[model samples]
Target: MAVTGGLIYRGIWKSSKRFGPFPKLAVAGILGFAVGKASYVGTCRNKFQQLGLEGGPGSGPWSRRGPSGRGHRSCHHVFEDCKKKDQVAPAGEA
Candidate 1:
């Protein structure tokens, strides 16, 4: 990122000379990296269900870490307990 920024900085520094500085562009490049990593983690989660973990936008995916660092469960191991508890929670909670 820094290298890219340096190249971009040199390429645009002269044009931006009138402004205070081109730091904002460099900051944007850095923030882009963080956004890239977060999206990557989400993409890697596609195997969550296959790993015996839940696969949804809500609670199911948050509660199933196995003893080993990696999760391992049959594909059918849905969150039966979570579903039961979910039924009794406030209507807005589901």
Candidate 2:
């Protein structure tokens, strides 16, 4: 990530003279991605707390399940929701 950021910064700096609005766009894209990742991590933490597994031994927001054994179930539900939407999309559209 640092490498990519460095490369982007270098490119922007090297072309600042001719790239008028492009530098702003590139910087915005990088910042947007950083913000999005941070937001997703926050959401995951909230989900962990809601599931009652905020800080279990091996079950964290990034864990597959809680130490109480509900980690997989929560992960499963997230994917299942997406699958359910996809399955219902055709009927809804028609």
Candidate 3:
């Protein structure tokens, strides 16, 4: 990751010398961050789909039991719900 970031920084620094150093650095940082985030999300979605967590036609066990009868849910929606559930205190413990 550090190597990738350094490459991005170097490329941006050389290509946009007209811009101030800080601006070039900022653009490279934002671009790197965005790329990293997108890669992570895509990987997670693919893994979930492979595991049948994102329910659909070939979704193993979850295909028949999805909240929607159609058996479909976005990876983002599923993960956000999981996060929300985890943050809440369970049952009478609270």
Q: What TM-score, computed on C-alpha atoms, does each candidate reach?
A: 0.35, 0.33, 0.37
lDDT of 1: 0.55
Against the reference, the lDDT scores of all candidates come to: 0.55, 0.59, 0.57
Which ten contiguous residues of candidate 3 have the minimum total lDDT?
Answer: 67-76
lDDT of 1 at 73: 39
Residue range 1-94, candidate 1, lDDT tens digits: 5654566668753335565345656666778888998888776677664565444333343446432222533344647765676677777532
- By lDDT, the candidates rank as 2, 3, 1
> Which consecutive 10 residues in model 2 have the weakest lDDT in total?
67-76
Please, what's the RMSD in Å of model 2? Answer: 15.4
Best-matching candidate per TM-score: 3
Q: Model 3 off-target regions past 4 Å?
A: 1-20, 55-66, 69-94
Q: Per-residue lDDT for 50-76 in model 3, tens only?
A: 765654345554454445433345333
Q: lDDT at 30 for candidate 2?
A: 86
- Candidate 1: where is the Cα deviation over 4 Å? 8-11, 14-22, 56-94
Best by lDDT: 2
